[model samples]
Target: MMPHQPSQWICAGRFPPPYDGQSLLTQELLELLSPEFSFIRADATARPPEGRIYAPGRLRLRRIPEMFRYIHHLRWLTTRYPLPILYAIFSGNPLGHIRDCVTFAWAIPRRRPVVVWTHNALLSLHASPLWHRTLHWLTRRATLFVFAGRSLYEPLRDILPEEQIAIIPNLVRRALLCSQTEVERKLAHADVSSRLRLLFVGHMLPEKGGWQLLEAAFLLRRHGVPFQLTYVGGWVTSHDASAFTRRIAELGLSRQIVHHGSIRDPETLRQLYLSHHLFLLPTKHPTEAQPTSILEALNAGCAVIGTPHATLPEIIQPGVNGFLVLQHPREIAEAIAHYWHNPNLWYSHARAARQLFVERFHPDRIRQQWIELLRRVQQSIPELAQVTT
Candidate 1:
C-alpha cells in the first residue's frame, strides 16, 4: 500500500524509534499485516504509552507539556482517517491510555469497529469495581478485544462476551532469534567452570528486583561460589545507580560485578543475551504482563529465574525451562546453585527454553494469529470487509 492511501485498517498505537516492546511489536504488525489490509498508522509517539524511563529529574518535567500537545493533535488526526476497523494498542496505564480513550469516546456515536489490544494483563484483572465498570462500558463499544494470554483475559470472560475476546501472544523478530543449535551451544555449561556468568537486564528500580539480584550476587560471593554477575541497562534514576554502587561496595561485590550502563548496540545486546548462562529477573512488579525480554532470553536459550508475577507463571514452567521464586536473595542463590552443581540440568533447561520459544512466541505463528484475528473482525463486522469506491 502506498503512503497517503485511504486504507480500511487504521492502526492507532505506539510506534518505534524508541525501541520499547509495545512500539516494536506495533511496528512489526504494521509491516506484517499490510498485505492483508492497506494501512495507516495512528502513532502515539509524543511520550508513548511505554518506555521513556521517567526519571525523577528535569527530563521527566520537560515531557509534561509535550505529552498533552501530542494527545491533542492525535485526537484531531484520528478524524482524518476512515477507521472502519481500528486496532489500538494499550498497556493499561489510565494516564497513558487517555488519548485512546478520547478517540474511542469521540467515535462512540459513529460506532465504528474498534479492536483494543491490551499488553498489561493485570490492569483490567486487578481494577477496582468502578474501574471494572468503566472498562465494561468502554469494551462493550468495541467489536473485538485482544490480549496476550488466557490468564490475562479469563477474568473478563463474564464482562466481555467470550466471542468478542482473542488471545494472541507477542511475537519476536526472526532476525534477533539465534539458531536453536547456536543457542544450545552458547548456553551449554562446561563440565566445570570457575565462574558462572549471571545476568540481570532491566531498569535499576527496586520494584524490578534490582536490589534483590545484587544481594543474591553478594550472597553467592559470600558462599565462595565462583560467579560473575553482569548488570546491564541504564539506571532509571541517578539515585538508583548510586544506591546500587553503594550496595555493591557494602557487600564487597565491586570486582565480581560488571555494570554495563545502557548498551545501545543491537549486536552487543544480542551477545549479552546469548552469552549469559542464566537470565535473572526475579521482579515483583505487579503490573507486569509477560515481558518481551523473557521471550528474548528464551530465544537465546538462557535458563531463566523469574518471580511468578502476573502472566509470568503462564510463560515460565518452574523446573522445566526456568525457576520461579520469590524475590529473596537466599532462594535465588539456591536456584542458581542447583544449575551450577548440575550442569546437565542447565543444558536440559537451556534446550527446553528454546523449544518453548519456538512452540509459542515465534513470529510465524503470531502472524497467523493476527491474520485470523483480522479475518474474524472483518467477517463478524461485515462493514469492515467492504472496500471503498
Candidate 2:
C-alpha cells in the first residue's frame, strides 16, 4: 500500500505580541500540532501601531486596514492549499465575529471542513442579541467546536450537538512545569514558618478582581494575619491604576502588598509560581475561559484560591487542590484564612494541585486528545489534490 499522506491544514489565529491567554493558547496549539501535519499559516494578529496595544474586545477603526491584510493573506493561502481543513480560533466579541464571518465566507462556499476552537465562555455574557445571532450563523457550518474545558460547553450546547463539541483543556508548556523531585521538595517545605506568600497574576482591572483581592488582603491584615500579597500584571486603564494606588495607601496595605507591573520573562514567572504558597484569581471577567496562571500554580504545587467562574471549579476542587469562593472580599479572605490556619491542609492541597495538573492538564494528555480530534476531522473530509505552483 502507498504510504498515507499527512493531512494538510490551515491553522488560523493570533499567536502573540500582546501575550494574553488566547494568543498563548493558540501558540501552544501550533507547537503541539506541527511537524506531523502540513499547514499554511493565516495569522490573525492585528499589528496595531507601535504605541497602541491590541484589544481583542474593542472595535478599533485604525485596525480595519490590518483586517483586510489578514483576509488577503488567507485568500492567497487558500488558493494554494486547496481544500485544506480550516482550524480557527473563535473570539467572543462582535469585532471577532466579523473576522470569523469573513474567514468562513471563503471556506463554506468550497464545502471545506472547518474546526472552530473557543477559549472563552463569553457567548452568554454578551449584552446584545445580535452577537448571539451572529455567532449562531457563523458556526452553523462548522464540523467541530472545541472548548478549553467542559464547563465552557453551556453557551454552545443549544447551538451545536454534543458529538460536534469536544472538550480539550489547555496545556502548560514543559518548561513551566516542575520536575517530580522539585514538586516534592516544594510541597515538603512550603514556607509555613514565614508570612504566607500569595500571588495574583492577571490584569489589574476591577473585573479581574484585583480590587477585590486588595480588599481581601486588607481584611486578612485586619484579622492579624501576617501575609504578603503580590500583584503581577499591568493595569488595564489609567483610571484603574490611579484607583489601585489610592486604595492601596488607603487600606494601609503598602507594607503588605507588592505590585510588579507585568513580568514577560517565562523564567521569572515560573520562579514566582514556585516561591508562592497560594495563587489567587477571583476574576469575574466576561472573557475568562481557563486562566493558565492557575495551571502554572498547580504545576508548581501552589494551592489555588479563585472564584467559581468559567472552568475554575473543574480545576479547583474545593477543599482539595483549592477553594472556589464568591467574588467578595470577605469570602476570599476567609478562604485564604482557611489555608493559613491549617498548615497541614495547605501542604496536602499543594501536593494534590500538582497531581491534578499531571493527570488533567499535562502536555502529553492534551496532545493525544488533539491528535485524535485532528484525525477525526481529517477522515471526515474527502481528500483534494494539492495545487501545483
Candidate 3:
C-alpha cells in the first residue's frame, strides 16, 4: 500500500499519566509520526499544546460531562481541520467505552474513517450484546481497527473483517534498546553481590500480580536464592497500595524487595531497566492485552518473567527470551531461582530478549506497520478520502 500524506491525523484518547500502555503508545506514535504528518491531539487529560489541542481534565468525570467534552472536542476538530483521520484509542472503563462510541457516532456523519486502537480483548466481549452489534456495525463503517496483539483478534474477528484488523505490537523508544554489552557494563557498575537482579516495573496492584510477585520473592528468599526485587510504578488505587505494602511486610521481604514507587520520566525508566538483570511482570489481569514494560525490559536486554496470560506468551518465548510461569507463586519462585543460579543462561536469555525487542517492538518498525495499515484502510474506505480531501 502506498503511503499518502494525510492532511492531518487527530489522535483522540486519554494520555500520559494516568500512565497507561495506550497513552504511552499514543505519545510515542505522535513523536515518531508527526514529522511526516500534520498531527493534532485531543487528550482526555490535559489540553494539548496550542496547535495540537487536547481536551482538558482527567477522565474520571461523570458520563454526561465526558461525552459533552468529547463532542465539543470533535466539533472543534471538524471546524479547525479538514475532517482529519480520527485515531481513537479505546479504554476499558465504562465511561471510556461510551466516549469511544460517541466519537464513532460523531465520525460517521462526517464520513471520516475511524481507527479504533484497542488493547483489551474483553473490550469487545464484555460490552452489551446490543453494544457489540452496534460496535460491529460501526466497525464495518470504520476504516481500520488496530489491536496490540493477535490474542485480541479472535473475539472481534466476526465484527471487523480480518483485512481491516492490524496487529501492530507495542513499540518502545530507540534509546530504550540497550545492547547486551551496555547492560553487562551497567550490571557490573551496579556491582550487587546477588547473581540475579529481578525488577518489576508496573503498578503495585493485585491485578498486576504484585502480591503474587512478593510471595514468589519470599519463597525464593526462603530457599536461599540471592536476588533483589524492585517494584516500580505508582499505586493507582488505595486497595492496591495497602495490599502490596501489607504483603511485603507479611512476606518479610523488606530487605529483598523494595518499592520504588512511580518513575514517570522515560530516561529514568531506561536507567532502571539498564541497571536490572531481569524483568518480572506477573500480571494476571484478563484485561491486560500487551504490557509495554515487558517490551521495555526486553529492549533493555533483561531476562523477562511473565504469567501465561494475555499477550505474555506472544512476547516471551519461554526458555528462549524469558520465562512464562503459571499464576502459582511457587512456580514464579522456581523460575526466578532457575535464572538466578545460572549466569550463562541469564545472559543468553537476555540477549535473545533484546533481539526480540529489536525485531518486534522498535518504534520505527512498528510505526511503518501502522502507516501501511492506515494506507490500506484509506484505500478500502473511500469515504476517508472524502473527509481529508
Best by lDDT: 2
lDDT digits (tens) for residues 176-268 of candidate 3: 666668766864564333657889886555677777877888888888888888888665555656777777888787788777776657788
> What TM-score quantifies how close candidate 1 is to the native fold?
0.88
- Candidate number achieving the greatest TM-score relative to the actual structure: 2
Alpha-carbon deviation at 310 in model 1, angstroms: 1.3
Among residues 3 or more apart in sequence or in different chains, the pairs in candidate 3 whose N, CA or C atoms overlap within 3 Å are: 48-54
Task: Please say which candidate is ahead in TM-score: 1 or 3.
Answer: 1
Of candidates 2 and 1, the better by TM-score: 2
**Worst ten-residue run, lDDT, model 3?**
48-57
lDDT of 1: 0.71
lDDT of 1 by residue, 224-331 (tens): 777888877656556667887998899988888998865545678788888888889898764566777788888898889999786778888899998999999999
Ranked by TM-score from best down, the candidates are 2, 1, 3
> Judged by TM-score relative to the true structure, which candidate is superior, 2 or 3?
2
C-alpha RMSD for every candidate? 3.4, 3.3, 5.0
Candidate 2: residue 168 Cα off by (Å):
0.4
lDDT of each: 0.71, 0.78, 0.70
Clash total of candidate 1:
0
> Given candidate 3, what's the lDDT at residue 170?
76
For model 2, how does the per-residue alpha-carbon lDDT over 1-389 read when each residue is reduced to its tens digit? Answer: 22324566777777777665566777877777766665666777765433234445787787788778877877776665554554556776667777777877863344666777776675553446767666777667677888888878776677667988889888886667788888888877677645789999876667788889888999999998789999888665566778889999999999998988777678888888888999999998887888888998999999999988889998999989889999999999998988778888899899899999998888889888987887777666545433211
